[model samples]
Every structure is written in structure tokens, then in C-alpha cells.
Target: MASAARPQGFTDDIVQRRVHRQRDQFLQCITKEKVLAIASSRRPGLSCDYFKDPERGSYNLCCFVAFEDGQRWVIRIPLAPCLAWGARSKLEREIATMQFIADKATIPLPKVYAYQLGDGLDPLSSFVILEYVDGRPLSATEVDSLSVDERARLYELLADVYIQLRRHIPFHRLFDDLEGLRPSEIQARYGQRGVLSSATEYTTMLLNLSDNALSNTRSRILDQEQGDDVLYHHHLFRRFVKEDWLDKRLDDGPFVRVHGDLQPFNCMVDERMEITSVLDWEWSRVVPVQYFQPPLWFTGHSTEFLALGYPYLRYLERLDEFLRIMRELEVQKYGDDLLSQEWEHQKSSGGFLVANALENWTDIDRFSTRHINRVWFRGTKDAPKRIETFIREDPTRRDLVERLCRAHEIYKKELQQLDGTSDPGDSATTPDPFPRRPFFGTWESSVPGIITTTLALGSLIIAITFGVWKKRNL
Candidate 1:
């Protein structure tokens, strides 16, 4: 399709400023010839313009290149010498993975317009051109502005996206190759005894976070002085999912071909609130489900979905939306009963396990400060006086705490049992599979644009919900 022209408020000069200021950093990595080619090839009718992305800290610099012809593209140019080696490889893998997903056309993913390596600019100055998806990010805004319907719709959309990808993508096997390490092998290398059990060791290793910051940082957000306590919360969340039967049975319980980074920033929407495109696959990975699940650190409260970011509101909503879409697609492909059973299994086995795994989250101290005080307390308003009394030093709340602890324990036990039955070393380990054909065409056609028109509607619905809730509750 031809590019749309720039909007009136967005002047060419303004666009140029945005490009050099934010997008030029990435462009700086490319050669003068390559830049000229990209710039010269600018579609005459394109509407969007290119601007550097200041938010990224990775190898590739991102430029928002939009043309007068309405061609909005997020061009990525790698700064490293080797595109497929070391940290740069991570970005390469992510691009490959996203390209793979985009070809499927199953969900709303931004289309990959063009990609090339060996440009002779930098040793590794590879570049990828992608569709410029429209819509404001859900994460950038406040929740109170969203309505109930929007919240529900957002959840529905999120579920659709997750289900589509999960059904088609064998995440575990992908990670095995991408990381060049098998699940059992990883466990053996990292596993420890005692204070660090099998699961705990794995969590520590795979969290992808530095040890000193999490374990030794001076920050005292949680009442507990120990970093392990903080790590424990993350540990519990991951373990809950990893130990579940449904996840284990699929391949590696913890791993999948996930959006690896399905944060709000990656998603795009149209004016109708539909999902227009899911951008940025640089963080895509075949990692553990816990790694992909939204960050659910609250003890008892629910925050507005957008603010929770990854593996929290966004993750859950994404997963939820994916499943819904998968059900429809599966029902069309196979039959309704098969999908029904799958959903049942997920909810009863893995989904229930997820809830159970989160049981420990109610321990007030384990929750992050935002979730603990704001979300948790707000959710338990009915029992606020009693809860408050307990917080103030009453011993009775200890039992409630114990109950939360016990629930967490039971959930943890279930996960352990799920894990015990499966051996990562088993011969029948799942094989990693890739699509045989190029995602779009025989490698000649431009990948179709991924624009979910529903996201705007979803966001608007949430804004409405917030208003209604505030009016009624206040």
C-alpha cells in the first residue's frame, strides 16, 4: 500500500527534527550510502516520517522514518560488528522470530517491510524496515481514563494475541536452540542444593537480572531487609507456572515461543481502539512462561491493567486475548470440543495452577510497594478496618498472613508434583520447528501490515470503566 501523507499538525520540519533527535542515533550506525538508499527510496505518498528512538539502549538504533506518502516505518540499524553473535545476536534472533510470526498473519504484528545484512557499511550494520503502526501506547497513559468495557475488551484482545501465538509457536524448543542449551542441561549447570533448590536455582539463573541489584541493593521498598525475600516473590511467580502440568506437558514447562517482551510499548492501535500492530521483537525469546507472564507482584489489590506492564496486566491480557483467538481459530480448524478441552485443561490445570502459584502474593511484605499499599488494600476494602487493625500490630492478622502463606505452599506443592512427573532429559523431548515458507511470500512481497483496529475501542472502554467505577465507588 502507498504511504499516507503526514498530518497537518505534523510538519515536514517537525518530522525531520523528530528523526534526527530521536531516530538519527540508529541511523548513525549505517553507512552514508545505505542512509541515502533508505532516504532516497522514501515513498512519494508516504505520510509518516522517521525519528530516532531515545528509549532503547540496545545495539540497534531505531528511527521512526515516515514519508510524505504515508509510509511509516521503524527502521532498525545495528551498531555492532557481528549481527548474529553475542548481544547483537539477541537482536538478530528477535528480528528473525518476529519475521517468522509476522509471516503467519495470525495476530496483529507489524509487518516487516525489508531486511538486509552485509551492507558493507559497518561490519554488522544490518537493517530492518517495518510498518509504522498507529495508536497511543496503553502504558503511557493513566488507568482512570479508561472505561470498564475497554478494560474487558483489552483483556479479550490480549487473550486473542497470546492464544494465536501459543497454539502455533512451540516456545520451548525455540529457546533450546536460540539459547543453545537444553532445559535439563541448563538445570544441571545452574541447579544447586539447600537454600537454592532446583527451581530456586533455575529462577536465579534465568531471571535475566543482575544478582547485586536485586539481592544487595540498598533500596528498602519491601519491609524485609533481605534481597532473597524480594527474589522470593519473583521466584514464587515463576515456580508457580513452571511447575504446572499443562506447561510441562507442552514441551519444557517454562519455555515457549513468546513475545519475550510483550509490554504496552510494543502494541499499536487504530482510532477505533483496535490493535494495529505489535512492534519490536528484539526481545523475543523462547523463554519460561514466568518470564513472559505479566508482573503480578501485588499482595491483594488489582491495578489498572495498562500500568502493570509485562507479565502483569499486559501479559495476562495478551495471553487471554491469544487464547480467545486460538479457540476461534481452533474451532474453525479442528472442532469446538477440542478447544474447549484445551481451555478447560489450561484453566483447571495451568490456569488454576497460575492462581494457586500466586497464592503467596497475598503476603503483604512480598508485594511491591505500589501493589501492596495501593492495589491490595484497595481490593480488600470490605475488610479494611480489620486489615488495618492487623497492620497496626494486632496479632489476629497473623492468621490471615498464615492462610496466605499456606495457600502459596499448596500451590507450590502442586507445581512441584507437576514437575516431578516430567523429566527434561527424556528422549521424547519436543523438537524446535520453524515455518517452512517465508512469512509473507516467496521472499519477494512486502509483509502484510499488522494493525489491530480494536485496541482503541478497548482503551476507550477502559476509560469509560474508570469513570463509572470512580463515580460509583467515590
Candidate 2:
């Protein structure tokens, strides 16, 4: 969902961004000629006008370029370097997923007019031209302003989008991302990953990725604090999930699709308050059910509003209302409504507490053992000595790399459609998979940022829950 009301600051921000784009930094990255080519090549012999002001979201630099006489398209250039955490394979995945949804579901997503994938380090040439959507974002102010029935009707439309995705998109494999990659790439990386064998696998892989990310410093954008707290929180969250606290009933996987950043800005709606197009598929992925939470709209929160006090209570009430309506519709169509069930189970298990803390960079420290507990060996004077001891004697830590390598082999093999004749993991028995990487590598890692950088920890939590066992109680 959007916001209570797009403050006047929104307009000012756009103007400021336009001015910022004119600066040398962004000009060096975006070339008018290249933007023109992307637009012109898609539709030749049209009166094309390159719009000078491009919209810069954290994920991409979007510009409206040369257009057909009757229609318009948007060229989105990802803001991250191709080498960034989510940037590597994101475009290919986004393009593939958008196309798949367009073909299979009634969900209104932008059609890909044309696209160019990024090279290993290039951001300029990587662009996707999508049919320009003409709609406003559904804002909390708008939803709250509505009568109860009006809001319900809007939620109905939103629910259908989720329903269609669940009904049509096959669970081919558990994907942390849903954007498309070449089958060749898929085959090479994970063997055709043609199976959604279990939920445990999905969560583990996500946790592994998250673990590696947190251990790296370059990703420590959220916390400039040079402390052990981030790692401690990582340890605590891992411990909590693995203990009997997680929603066990729903932990069994057939990973479900999530519009990773289903914030209001991406959810475009017509005047009638319906989902016209969901922008930005780059972050879309098949998250494990345990990690799943209600879309941000229902939560009435954003990066702008990060607390869980009143907003969270309001979220509960709104969620119940929305799900009740969605459940009725879902049952009528499919006779089963696992989505609603998963949401309830997840909330009851308090998984979102970890999610909110981990996802919000500023809040991560609050969950650390030091803040929550001072008597344990972890929080006591023996803490430093204990960490070293745990690092050396912790069986799970010693074999984490090997375990990940094996899991990757399973992923690669399953995707490749190959017989499992050989599977050899990493040769080194290093405690850290990405020991040299910065940010998240500290104790647990690095800290949080926006929607994209959590993969390392994302995988870490999943692993704790499903893939790796807690050998010793911390």
C-alpha cells in the first residue's frame, strides 16, 4: 500500500531528483543516445522524444524515451551496479517473470517492450522497456479515507492478484527470486531446480545467502556502528527461529511467490482503486512460507514508518478484515486458501518480529543478546572468549560452507535436469563462506539496508530453520 497521503514533500523530492540527475555523477552513468536506442529499436519510425528527467528509485533510474505515436514505454535502468547483491541476475529474472505472469495470469503487470541484460559490472547498457502504466499508487490515506466496503473492494482486487499468482505460477522450484534466467544458466548453477522438494531447503538457502551477506562489510550500509551487536542479533534471530518458536505447521515448503517490495509505489491503481500494474519485478521471489508476511499496505508501515507499536495493531485489524474477504473469494475459486492460513500462522509464531528487525537496519541492535540478556555467557564478561570458542568448537559453523556447497549442488543439479551422479562441495573448511567480504561478515554480518541487501541473512535465517541444525544452545 502507498501512504497516508503523499506529502507535498513527494513533489519536492521529485523536483530535487530531477535536479540531481543533471549533476555530473548520474550524467556519467546514463547516456541519452543509449536510452534513445532502447526506445527506438523497440518501435522504429516513430516521433520519439527523450524525456530529460528520469525517475530514480533506489532500484533503478527510469526514463521515458522515444515512443510509438500512440503508446508510451518506460526504460528502467537498475541503480545498483551489476555486481551488487541483487543486481547480478535480477534483470534477467525480472524480464522472465513479467513475461510469465503476463502470459499466465490476469494480474496487470507492465508488458516488456524490450530489454537488455547487464554485463558483470555495467549498469548503463542494462535496461528494460516496459509499457508505461497510467495509474496512481494505492495509498493508506486513500484506503483509510474509504468506507469499509470501498476498502474491502480494493483489497478484493489486490487479493485476486495474489490468488492468480498462486493458482497459475507453478512451483517449479523454490526460488529466492522469480525473475527469469536462461535455462542454460539455471542448469549450470543448480540442475534445472525442477523440484520444490521441501520448505526447509528454501529457507536454508535464503539463510545461507543472508549469512554470507551479513559477514561482508561492503554491505554494512545500515549500521555504521562498529560493534558486535549486529552479529549478536544475527545469532539470536537464528536461535529463536530454530528453537520451537517458528510456525512448524507451515514450515513445510512449497515456497510461495512474493512481490518482494509490495509497497504502495509499486501497486498502481486506476481511479477505482484496483491494481493496474505492479512495477519492479526485480525483487520478486518465492519466499518460504515462514518468512512470508502480509503485504506492506496492510501493515500501514513503510521505511518511513518503521515502528511496530500502533501501526502493528492497526495492521492486525486490517489484516483480519482483508483476509476474511480474500478467503471467501479464494475458497469459491480454488476450494482451499493456504495463503490466508500461512499469514495467520506466521503472525502467531512472531516470525515477522525477526523480519521487521532484520529488514530495518536501525532496529537490528534491539534484538541482540547484549540488550535482551546480560547474564548469559554471550552477554557476560566471557563473551569475547566464548565467541572464539564457539567459532572453533561450533560444529555447525565449521561445516556451514560445506553444507552450503552441497545445497548449491542440489540446487544446481535439480535445475540442470541431471542425474545426481556427482556432488562435491567447497574444498576449504573455512568457518565463513565469504570470509573476505565486508559488512555482514562480522559476527553475523553486516547490517541491513533497503529491500535488496538482505539475501545473505535471508538465507541465514532459512538455514537455521530448515537446512542447518543448531548443534549447541547459545
Clash number for every model?
83, 50
Score every model by TM-score. 0.47, 0.64
Consecutive 10-residue window with the lowest summed lDDT within model 2: 1-10
- Computed on alpha carbons, the lDDT of every model, listed in order, comes to 0.39, 0.51
Q: On residues 247-297, what C-alpha lDDT tens digit does candidate 1 reach at each position?
A: 433334434455544555455655555666666565454444433343221
For residues 1-474, write the lDDT of model 2, one tens digit per residue. Answer: 001122111011222222333332433645667677667766678767765356545455667664546677777776553123444355666666666677678888887766665564445656667777777666655677887777888888888877776667645446343211122233233444433345554444333434444443331322212223345445655665556444455555555566665665567877877678877666556655555556655655642332333455566788788889889988898898877776666654234655554444344444333232332233446555545455466665534434444544554444344233253221212132111222111111112233332222221111112111113111
| TM-score of decoy 1 | 0.47
Task: Please list the residue runs of candidate 1 whose C-alpha ends up more than 4 Å from where it truly belongs after superposition.
Answer: 1-37, 41-60, 67-70, 78-88, 118-124, 139-153, 171-255, 288-334, 337-474
